[model samples]
Target: MDIRTLQEELVQYSKTIGIDKIGFASASPFIELKERLVRQQELGYQSGFEEPDLDKRTNPELVLPQAKSIIAIALAYPSKLKDAPRSTRSERRGIFCRASWGQDYHDVLRDRLRKLEAFLQERVPTCKVKSMVDTGELSDRAVAERAGIGWSGKNCAIITPEFGSYVYLGEMITDLPFIPDKPIEDNCGTCTKCIDACPTGALIQGGQLDSNKCIAFITQTKGFIADQYREKIGNRLYGCDTCQLVCPENKGKDFHFHEEMEPDPEVVKPVLKPLLSMSNREFKERFGSISGSWRGKKPIQRNAIIALAHYKDQSAIDELKKVLIEDPRPVMRGTAAWAIGKIDGESSQEILLNAKNKEKDQDVLNEIEKGLQLITR
Candidate 1:
């Protein structure tokens, strides 16, 4: 078979493997991105994107030993809105961004890519094909842009006409040669909605994110959030979608028809009351297969309490009280106290004082005092 016919077959195989968008590009070094990786690693921002190694990510050779061509595929996570009054102005958003609203994108994307790789291996017994989703050092986004899958928008995401940036990216690095598509240029001239919409100023310059200030980064980091950043985090429970939501490219476009990207019902703007009530085992059991389960319950619960406090939702007081008293994680108790103070207000004065008296952990007690202070103020 000709290379075009062989590549065409892989595309068909990718559809069977559950990929929503598949595009092809030959392997080429990305010199500009490699230089930027140095700064990204030095700043401690990559985080869960990769293990803490500057070299492993900067060098594509680490991903595929004899890499010659790359096939970049995109899987769109449905950005469907449930039938309700969501996306409202008084937003205490407890939901994830559409990218992560469903099954773990990494899991879903990787499985499909692996299937494609296996099929390629079966067809060409001597050729080498490696499937990866961010595990490899290859530039997934750059390769995607080159593949005609999408252009890299000002948001630094590969934006395609089909799904915007809601699609998950995965790749197959292989030895076989194939015709590569020409890359499209940036179409975001004079548009700054995504940059302007970043609440924490993470999007400082076009296509740049200061992960230190990013709420998505802040939520997952293993330390206390700095005092100045609390109010800016708003009510985002998991990840913030302000940038994507405000993009003109995403405007008036509906993703409701796409079932592959549909978010699971359990996490779609989940009530804070239910989230705080979960025991660790229950959390693991409930979210094990979902995208939110990757960090375990503590991170999500901590963010939930923060959101409740920020929103001043009185309905969360009961759950917050229980968390303050019984959560094994001190971080949870401290965040709960802070949230309770913000939520219960004058009505929860007694609960606040009792919690203050009962709180033994120093950090948690300090937060209790802060909660009390918020009440007094």
Candidate 2:
């Protein structure tokens, strides 16, 4: 079969299989991305979740020796939740960002890539293919942008005019030389809304992020979040969508294309108090399937405490106190202490004092001291 004809067939087949967009790009070194990545490293802007090897990351040849073309795919995910649960004064809720709304995107995208690979293998028996989703060394955004799936927006997301930025990207490197698609024009001209709206100023400049200041990255960390960012984190349990939310392109762009991408309101926006005491089994049973739960329960629970504090929900004090005293993780206990301080300051004085007396962990003790100070002040 002709490579271009096969590419056309693959594009059509992709739509039948739930791929919202598909494009092809030359499997060449990402020269500009390499320099930008080097700059990001020198400035310490990386989130540390990316593949560390720059050589393999920028050069398709390094990832797949015989790579001739790269096929990029995008699957549109739901940006809006139906029947969304509200965070009441009594039952304060913490939110998982839209990116983690339904099923773990890693699993969903991988499934699509697997199907694409299978389709290619069936058509061209000798075709060599290497496929990857977000976790892969290759930058999904870079490949997607090059393939005309979207233009890389100032918010550092691939912004498709069709789906807005509400899409999951994946790619497959193949030996077949498919005709590459023309790159998309930059549609985010003069738009600084995403940059201006970042609560913590994590969007340092257009298309560059200081991951250290990013709430999305912070929420996934195991350690206690720094004092400065804790307040800015607001009610987010996992990830931050401030950049996307502020983008004009994402306005009124909600697609419920895939059933698995549909969000369960209660799961994505759960009551903050119960999360404080949720057992590992309970957390896994409740939230294990979602992408937000990948860092496990500690971060979520910690963020829940912070969210409760952000609301100053006195109703959650008892739960916060319980977490401060009994949670085995120092980060959790410490964060709970801070939340208690923020919530019931004067009223939580005794609780903070008592925890300070018995807490052996220096970090937890420090947090307990901060709690006491909050009460006294």
Candidate 3:
């Protein structure tokens, strides 16, 4: 196979697909991935599936019976106007992560990759092509590093000089053989900013992440968090950006813009009042198209009450009381009870006591008591 000739065509194809960077590498198997997977399993970070042998994902012999090259591409999620704090709920704001601030990259990348693969197959009818995004068993970042796209940061993110670590990575595993680019040296230095700013210690060690300890995981958790972590969740109802914010490599980068992911002007500051009164139908209508909408409304609704509690807003008392009494979800009731305790003074205690006395649900009573403790203490 004329590998160099194909590389040239493929690189240009990637650019035409809107990818900012592209590189090629030999299809060798990963050796370190095993240890990492073992560690993730031990740390209880495995996504409910045991790691199958790494070979199935990284080894060309297994990935594509004749796989000889891996093509990696990066899309810059640059921000244009992100330096400002999230605007108030009444004002238009762009609080999305640099990556998600625009149209869904998954849709963009998958469509483009399919197009590129089709272009290749039209010329080489027998060639095989498979494309994925953080998908399957392959080490996406490892492939990018070996392909000479960029060096890996200590935070476990791949970083390019022009785009920092805010790029989404995807790959095309093909049957054509290509000369692989050499890997780059690490440029993370001694920076510990990402580690220090991680509110939940997601970054436990070099290139190691305990996703369970990850705020992103917590906020997106499918089930209820243990009550212990609830108090620490703060006002954040969706995703957490603390670690990314503190990364030096991300400094001075442009703010990525996209109209779809722009923070809803009505919820930019993520206030508690509008949230407290939202019915399930209203919650669906408001956040239906956004990323956080997938988990449904319980987590955000629970988080709303937590924020109201921390803010100690007396104005939120009546609305919170309504949720505490009317919301079917016990989790929301618990959090709303806490918010009422924080906002209401002496009389609020009486309300909670009355609810506790009348409430038949053990969970609701427990939530009421938790709120009582918050105020009493």
Candidate 4:
């Protein structure tokens, strides 16, 4: 088989199947990435959502025996939402990051990779292929960078010259010995915009990120958010886009190429008050299609409460009081207590005083006390 010819054919096939950009890369062990991963782990900067085994993550041979090459693909998502809903004082809204605006990229990219795998198998029946999306053991960004898909940006995202940093990345490991493409040069020279725009200063120096302090990571946690970060999070429901939004390369780079990538304004930026009372089934039915719903409704609802507080939405005081009294989750109840104090309605102090006597959870009681203090102040 002419590996070079097959590589060219695969690139053409990728274009037909809606893959915006594709590149071939050697399937050798990711030595530099392994060192970086180890350093991130040592510094406790990892989001704890990554594949834990370092060896499995770095070595392609472990995932697919005799892996000779990797094929990386990038699909650009729309940066601008068309006719987005307005967030008024009476109807405050929280936003999901652009990455989560469309249908889950995992499913979209996996479908594309499956088609590519079938195409390869038809031509080379004996070839073995393994495909992965974001949650895979292999680092999609590292693979994309190695495949010349893009340069790793200062915000720790793959920044393609054509699509900027708004592209969704996926990769496939194969036994076919395709020639690799040269990596793109890093073009984020002396750019401090992403680092400066980070709400919690999560972006350290340039490329490094402290995931513990990242609003994107914090918004997904299913627990009480620390006081310092509550205000910093603003109206972000699922993920934070401050770093990406401020990138000069990403400026004016909005692509509505894929239909599935189009966002429903109401879904991505829903009213905060309605979200606080949404049932699990309702949450799943409305937001299940989007990637942000993967963490379930608890975290999103929790963030909604924080957003209401950030706005000091007095209109949501009634709903906040209901959640404080009836929500089964202690985290929700406690957060509502805190949000109530922040909102500081006409009767918020009395409501908190009443809940303070019946609340059994020590943490909830503490939050109630905090609420009481805020209302009195």
Q: Which candidate number maximizes lDDT?
A: 4
Q: What is the TM-score of each predicted model, taking all chains together?
A: 0.89, 0.98, 0.85, 0.99
- Score each candidate by Cα lDDT: 0.74, 0.91, 0.69, 0.94
Runs with alpha carbons beyond 4 Å of true place in candidate 4: none
Q: Of the candidates shown, which would achieve the greatest TM-score relative to the real structure?
A: 4
Model 4 gets an lDDT of 0.94
Residue-pair clash count for candidate 1 = 2
| lDDT score, candidate 2 | 0.91
Instruction: Give the runs in model 1 whose Cα sits over 4 Å from its true position.
Output: 15-17, 42-45, 85-93, 256-260
Order of all candidates by TM-score, from best down to worst? 4, 2, 1, 3
Q: Model 3, residue 26: displacement in angstroms? A: 2.7
RMSD, one per candidate, in order: 2.8, 1.0, 3.4, 0.8
- How do the residues 80-110 of candidate 1 rate in per-residue lDDT, one tens digit apiece? 6665335333334576656667667777777
Residue 262, candidate 1: how far off, in angstroms? 2.2
Expressed as tens digits, the lDDT of each residue in 1-377 for candidate 4 is 69888888989999999999999899999999999999999999999999999998999999999999999999999999999999999999999999998899999999999999999999999999999999998999999999999999989999999999999999999999999999999999998999988889899878899999999999999988988999899999989888889999999999999999999999999999999889999999999999999999999999999999999999999999999999999999999999999889898989999999899999999999888888855
What local lDDT does model 3 show for residue 48? 44
Q: 1-377, model 3: which lDDT tens digit per residue? A: 47578778877776765667888888777667666676677777754432366557546568677788888887776544333455343321223334434445666667667887897898789999778776555777888888888887767789887778877788888888777888878888888888877777778876787777776667666554657666667777776767667787788875443334344444434445677677789987766655556667777777666666655666667777788777777777776776677666656787788778767778778778877887763
lDDT accuracy of residue 186 in candidate 3:
86
Cα error, residue 319 of model 1, in Å, equals 2.5
